[model samples]
Target: MIDPHHAPTGTAYATAPSIVQEICLIAEASGSGPSDVSGDREFRLRKAALLDCIAVQERARYGVAASADADDAAEVAAEWLVEYDVAHSGLSRKGRDLVLAEEYRDYVRAEYEAWSRSQAV
Candidate 1:
């Protein structure tokens, strides 16, 4: 099985693995962001990261975890990101209506796969 816990800390993914790790890293984000980000952006990212972690953790209480859980968590996190964009970037009405779940899911799946890939199983 792939172990996502020790995966590299990069999130730039071009594809996705069909299955996730035994544990989800998105649920474990420490929220201790990089020390370089010192501004409202950092706070906003932390808040969104909190949203992502909480939602994913909550999602785990249901039935067996599925790949879609990542999508669900990403969608929830995107809500906060959209709110920030609306307030700061002036997102269009169309933009406000959509949650960029795929992008965030890509991150989740990518992180999991990174650890999974490094494992022997």
Candidate 2:
């Protein structure tokens, strides 16, 4: 799991806005209730999913585990947010933007799980 507090030196990738944008788009399109992007579960799960998707889509996009990785992960997370169409999209009070971030976390988790499963085989 990528530490929210501690990012890689000289590679601290920050793109929370991208996820915010996706969340807004989703809410705009679906017209549903607020999204469930918050707390530990949401962040961890969605962040994982985002990472996995980025890796599958393209490793080079992340560069390392710093700038590129964070950026790609953010993009994937934002994508999920937009895709989910969670209402009240921009409801993150702490500026963390949990709503959009959660989806990406889920994506990254799924990616690792699949990879782990394959390795077990």
Candidate 3:
């Protein structure tokens, strides 16, 4: 229930392609030639997952009432994203990605809901 209006816009998240680009670079360096079909597919999937997580986090952080504690929400969301990145950094070819997992999204939603309730009280 994030307030779309309160969500930060035009920030680095909007223009930062470095995250996915770095992943692609790594794939290429790992002996999966630049044109490797599997590598390309993995890159696309990873990119989508990363963006989805960002969107989810942003909504969870900003969707709450404006009166809620913004600082606390922001901190929690930031921490979550960092941990998510670390967790997915070593994904194997056949390993399910965090972004594609319903459990991870649910976890974020649950955390946000808890934080929002705490702030409301």
Clash total of candidate 1: 1
Model 2, 14-73: lDDT tens per residue? 222244453454445445446543433344334534444344334344455545655566
lDDT of each: 0.42, 0.43, 0.42
Worst 10 residues of 3 by lDDT: 7-16
Q: Can you tell me which runs of candidate 3 are displaced by over 4 Å?
A: 1-39, 64-121
Model 2 spans with C-alpha error above 4 angstroms: 1-31, 40-44, 60-121
Q: Evaluate model 3: give its lDDT.
A: 0.42
Count of clashing residue pairs in every prediction? 1, 24, 5
What are the root-mean-square deviations of the candidates from the true structure over C-alphas?
Answer: 9.9, 12.8, 14.3
Give per-residue lDDT, candidate 1, residue 1: 22
Once superposed on the true structure, which residue ranges of model 1 sit more than 4 Å away at CA?
A: 1-39, 42-65, 95-121
> How far off is residue 67 in model 3, in Å?
18
